[model samples]
Target: MEPKREFFPKVKKTVMPRPYFATEKDVLGHRGTAAAVDAAIYGSNWYLDKEQGLIEIYDAGAAISFFNLLPRKDKYEKEGLYLRLKIAYRTTENANVNLRNFSGNHVTLPNSLTGAMYDDPQTYWWVTDDLTLNINSIFSGEKLWIQRVDWEWMSKEIIYEDELFAKNTILYRSLEEVQKLYSEKELTDDDVKDFLRDKIKNDDWFAKKCLVMLREEQLMGEKLVKLFEDSGLEL
Candidate 1:
């Protein structure tokens, strides 16, 4: 008897939707990461497209960090615009983060200015989450019309060293796990640290990675002291 052929299951991608949006101008402050994104999204271009919106950046290994956005408002913000535009990628896009870079439509957002993208409400996006594993990698698809939001993201210097570093070890988890652990309920500092510390002892690689994270500016002054205090580790 012949076996039945089945299609691959939809892959759940790890996407961080909370991002600070700025006109292609304000984001210029992060020239280094911005350039890398530009290269990944637009090949080798001396200038960013007027319609492009520089989204987020992860400066960990300086490996991959950037977003390409298409514009919607009447005028696009350039390098010298005294304009303030905030935006957020709405996560309520159907079932999951739709893949496929085909932002050529206009969508309405709640508060922030409206924008255009290469997406349609009726059609299912072709790009699957499997392509972008959410490990601070380059995302070069769908110029989205993200709505501006008024939220302060951690300083760009934050590096998110922990998030990136954790991937190599057993601590790595899909966004679903993150959502379950923290999103659904509250976790006390001690409880959180205790849980993770226990896992650390079980996973040697995870423990080693934590040490590296500490070395990367994570240990110093109060930060160093706090690590021990939080983990209930003496000295």
Candidate 2:
């Protein structure tokens, strides 16, 4: 006999809107003194080359501040937001830069000479806060040059399989089946607990199946697992 294949709901993804850019005018201030460098050499200082659109740093413990750059909290309270930096920089030695919000939540930028975009691994919780970019140079002569900064919302909707199932026709049938099972008796707290336990178990099973199907696509699968864990569903 042939084995029956499991069918799962089709996952839907709505692409997020384009990212918003922050211009040089948005820069508010700096923590350390900005000095001019006549030669290619640098010291324990920072330089803002407005003409070249770069914020150059030569040592640790220096920061560049920017105005609060995100929308109101209510705007993305449910979906969450992200901060990203578009930097074209080179370092004499290994360096790290921290992108921090007013609330002090931050993400680090590891050493990279090639120009590329870097996203904050943490979600932007405080949408209405100023931002800062702190530089950390590993060596005395290490240098860094920051080119640009931008931010955006999460790229896709975060929905769990159980949440989707709750809106499906199968959920209605399941509820009706439970109702029929208790038709003759008044539902009690114990009965409700039992029902919820069964429902959760069923939802967990469905989520696991969905995860298995998504496993090959690692990013999607990891996202699904995070959603499942957040929703209190077992893997």
User: Which candidate's lDDT is highest?
Assistant: 2
- lDDT by residue for model 2 (95-206), tens: 6655453345565556777655554434434332444555544456666776655544342334566788665422213556545654687779999989867776779886
RMSD, candidate 1, Å: 23.0
Q: Give the lowest summed-lDDT range of ten residues in model 2.
A: 30-39
Task: Count clashes in each candidate, considering only residues at least 3 apart in sequence or on different chains.
Answer: 11, 0
- Tens-place lDDT per residue, model 1, 143-166, is 222222221111112235577765
Error of 1 at 179 (Å): 17
- How many clashing residue pairs are found in candidate 2? 0
